[model samples]
Target: MVLYKTPNLKTILLNVFQDGILPYDIEDVLSLLVQKHYLMNKEQFLNYYKNDINQFWRDVASLGFKRDEKKATAESNDINDLKEYPEDNDNDFNIDDFFDSDEFKKRSDAEDIDNDAFKRNVSLIKDYQGINNSNERKNEKLNDICKINQRLVEKIAGKYEKMVRGTCLNIDDLIAFGNHGLLKAIDKFVPDMGYQFSTYATWWIRQSITRGIADESRVIRLPVHLHEKIMKIKNEERQYENEFGAIDASELCKNINMSDDEYWRFKSIAYQFDQITHLETIVGTEGDTELQDLLPITITVGSKSVPPDYMLTPEELFEKKELHDELENTLECLTSREAEVIKLRFAINKPDTMTLEEVGEIFHVTRERIRQIEAKALRKLRHPSKSKKLKDFIKG
Candidate 1:
């Protein structure tokens, strides 16, 4: 990546002008250098130029080390040393006019000009004239096409405006994006390809509009791969539903060739597009409770009946104490390792429980071996001899 520093636009433009670069050629060079080589978009380049034309030129100049070195050398020269070219003062000035002048004829006759130098100069003049004529004809053709197709451009832009109506972008923004696509199509489309202009332009127009929406419309932007997958899945689902009625989850997963976990994770992300809601949104005709206030609270045995508060009742507190004691007594009947495994697995002393794999790791045993030990310990506790100790609690 090239890290560019802004250059002096006046100095850069002066150097380019001194080198006899045409305005149209300068524009082409700027577009190619900024968009292709520097990795900047057209809009960003335009904005930079609009802000400061001189600064824009300077920055563009910085892209070339040779240009900057030349500029530095020129800047170091004395003002009296710099000479202006005749072309700088007059657009109509021609080399042919210089050759046709009486002063030039007098000098040539007196100096005895070399035949080779005269032939070379004449060839150079012809080449310049040919290039200038070709450019003029090209400009005229482009202008005529643009003038004739202005209405067609507007129509295409309007169509895309309607298509992307509900996006974060307004109709004007969509139309602007569509117009850019249309302009690019005009520049690239070939009549020899045997396709209608509209047919070729449609893809570019829709691509530009949809890309804008996909990149800008969402509150939370998804990764491009995920977004494409979600869109593909949606399209497939619609096709399947139309042809085969309601689709099964397993069949849908198979069609997409995704595992259960992957499919569900994608489904959850896709569903978020519809699930977004504001906290202050009213839910019912009553118009009293907001969505946030209506969110469900899990109701336990002694949970509060009054809004936003909770406390344990006497009876529930006593029942919980009894249950704790019975659990401890039952655990005591098992071997130490068995008891420890059971407690960790069930989260008896912690808010989160350990998995079978975690318990196996702690005891340096296979998961299946830990399962066997737990089952055996449970069987021993459930035997008639051990059952008598907790018979009352079991009855309750």
Candidate 2:
């Protein structure tokens, strides 16, 4: 880790921005750098950086870091000697504070940083003694920059680690993403632009970490860019549901500027990320049953809810068997022809009930003759002794 003690702001900025002596040169460098690397235009670049370039001067002034341009011009025309950056004269303002963890805001500075290693790590950033036009020197400087800001990446990653709780990501993964953002920040850093590097780097660090979470939070990952829109739609749905008690798909599509087909496709993909509960997950007040207990073994179409055969309790199974046996015994009281006719008409132990004409064709009789046989069989079964047992199974 690159440890740095708080140094004079001028020395730090000068060492970092030595390649570009003028602010205008730094601007051009940044413009071409972002365009070549990120393919971002001016507006997109500002949005990505989370600040307007025009506001840099104002921000520096508010932070008490801005110096008078006239005084600097009069002091020296040479960039090497110009007082373009501020002297750290105020006790209240420290560049290191920019990298402080906002999570520990409630604690005092002494309480927040209790680590002895961190205390020992504090040292002034190494000067640009070896930095020059040489490739080795440039690479050395780049390593120095990355090392010095390593803690900043870790701190920023700490904040994001919470955002991705319950996700597949751990702190190490988040820190990796934060390091990528730190590299991007180093590439884009223009120290002469009047903002602390940490302040600027925070945006890139957060963007990279969040983009990583968005891309990898699910079993089936989505594009990093679409995550923003997906979050917007979800937030809108929550708000709409809270206000209206329900959501209208059409209204929600209009609100998010999505077509019905696109919204449904996204919804389907989103479902894939929903939490998976194990069949063994406990349920009920006493926690005596598993999740699978509540699920049906078989689903029948156009029928009232009834337990599948495998799900039936011992008593229910016994009752069903008894009723079926009783019905079979009652059918035996009829003549063979009458029993067969009744069985065919009522669909007993059959897939479908037969019409009078169908039964007549089967028995080689007319429909009227088959009907008389069915009526006679019903009259016999309607006798109190024969009907009494079957009546117990029917509800009023």
Candidate 3:
């Protein structure tokens, strides 16, 4: 788990690297989002769903989920047999935008541009993007529709995740939003029309998420005034810092005409509302017993230790089942208090730790007693019996 206590816009953007996982408790806040009653259910009324979502319907319908697809068509046999569509009329659709940019090229190698094939795909998107009210018939070829839409879904997935105002989200949630938006566009697309389906679908995706949020949130906590203040003042200040180098929060306090405490409160609350969950600390596991000793004296732990399996490999992955078993087994061998010290040392510890002299002050132990416990734990790790269990604990 990637824990975080705070997140800036950059941190939020980085979260999208996961594609659609909108993490943090933002999903919790989504319930607070208000869905404006503009053209209520217009999207559903218009039959706008592209590939994946459409297939979701078909599969369900086929399994006698709903009666709609039962008499629908022979073409809708399965996901692959769904639909395909050719390129739309006369427009130069560019896949270059979908391709990683030059900045990405500078960091990595340039992607292969199958110019001919790309142009055809572009034409396809433009063709479908143009589709208007007249073209959407209830009975359409399932395959042509599904294939064109699936590719389009893949393409739009990037933008829907990227274009949102705030960057905070889990990788999986962002990807889900993008995929949902892309697929939504497919079902509602009118290729003969002039406007792009992407423009339309972005709204749909946002709407789905927003509607979901509104339905679930107990109270709408994001007041419009605060949102405006955050968007205007906070975003600009950060941008100014990026452009001019850096500014202290003190400078920001004077500029914003608020006390440091008040300013930070506003900033923190605003960022929280924006759902910018990032930082290793905030996302990381809590009550991590292994991490207890590495931390400082001021820290505290209440959460359970994070399982080893959650850590990514080649960095510090321990065999979770085995490591957990080791810890459980090792605990049996130690005194209740020894276990307490070990947990306190790593999990409950905080930044800028006290020296052994200071820790002795709190525990009423001579520095020697503390030293013995620390050394004993270290010595235990040298033995193969306790090494794996000792290793399973995380450090903040």
Candidate 4:
């Protein structure tokens, strides 16, 4: 018998979430790398994680997640649970504090300070004996600037992936850019000039990544050179008609001296149109309404409370009002706990109010017991005939 060792996407996702990087969509590229390299286990992952905690945070938690393990698996068949994202592990911030996590204000405050003496304090510089090119030497030496803060980069990347799509860049890339940026800063760095290496290097690393991303992004977008040519072709066609009159397709082809097939290809290239975006740009930004949008408007009005008597009309509203009244009468069959759970969960709509843990805490039961009850409740809700909707909703 053979025992195979390989980490799958699902396992990596669970492990990442368990490891305290916010439970969100895993980076597909990182998943591919993990699978290809056979470095899915904990020890190997620590090497990727420990050095670049901020970067790891961004890569793992890029998805704005609402569901915990129980909620995710309540609907999914293959997975039993989505591992819960850890509580604020470092106690650096509270779960309720959203803007504080990124710490933009503290940084902005630093810019207001003017301390020339404090600025030139380069005592942290490491000693390097032998090196050749000034740029290369500076690059190697620049690693000292953010040596400790690189760990913060790892954390952000690992935990904040859902928030920043560009975090597709992984740990090695972060370090490489940091090192490279530091080198550039070194070449530009002057003890005589008076500036802190740390601040400058931060800017350098950001520049390196931004430039790299622009280059990388340009690859995914149609090349600018191609777009330029396409635009020129279009302009020429416009000019062709403006100066030479409304020439038919055959006449334009005759002017261009291309055969029918080649002209068609050229025309196709020059006249390419972006469907949805083109309409949005042309008509002041409105496009086809998605099913997701239509309900939001009506739901918002209902949620804010359109008065029941003020809102209901005779025709369709009467039928809906009657049906809703009937449904509530049926809901009267459920117990208070069941009714509250059902209404809060589905009827009134709270996206993420009570976690299973929180619910268990309230009822003085184990989380596992809560799970069993929740599953039972959900199963009952799925087939309302099996149990009343409100009753089954609580069971879940």
| Model 1 clashing residue pairs (backbone) | 7-58, 7-59, 9-54
lDDT of 1: 0.51
Candidate with better lDDT, 1 vs 2:
2
Give candidate 1's total backbone clashes: 3
lDDT of 1 at 284: 91
How many backbone clashes does every candidate have? Answer: 3, 4, 69, 36
Q: Any idea what lDDT model 3 has?
A: 0.40
Give, for candidate 3, the lowest lDDT window spanning 10 residues.
102-111
Model 1 TM-score on a 0 to 1 scale: 0.33
For candidate 4, the lDDT comes to: 0.41
Q: Please, what are the lDDT tens digits per residue for candidate 3 over residues 38-104?
A: 2134333234333123333233223332211112121102111211212221111222221211211
Q: Which stretches of candidate 1 lie over 4 Å from their true place?
A: 1-176, 189-197, 241-245, 277-396
List runs of model 2 lying over 4 Å from the truth: 1-155, 158-163, 273-396
RMSD of 1: 21.6
Give the lDDT of residue 268 in candidate 1: 56
1-396 per-residue lDDT for model 2 (tens digits): 110123443454344445424243225535653544433455554564465443443333333444322222211011111111222221122222222323212332222333342232222112332345677766766666666667767776776666567777899999998888767666554444443445555556665666677767765676644555566666677787777766666677788798866765665445434332334589889988765445432212122123234445455678888887998999999999999999899877765689999999998989999999999999999999999989999868
Candidate no. 3 TM-score: 0.27
Which candidate leads the pack in lDDT? 2
Q: For each candidate, what TM-score against the reference?
A: 0.33, 0.37, 0.27, 0.23
Cα lDDT of model 4 by residue, 329-381, tens digit:
65565666665555544444344457667777877888787677666555655
- The RMSD of every model to the true structure, in order and in angstroms, is 21.6, 19.3, 23.3, 28.1
lDDT (Cα, 0-100) at 161 in candidate 1: 55
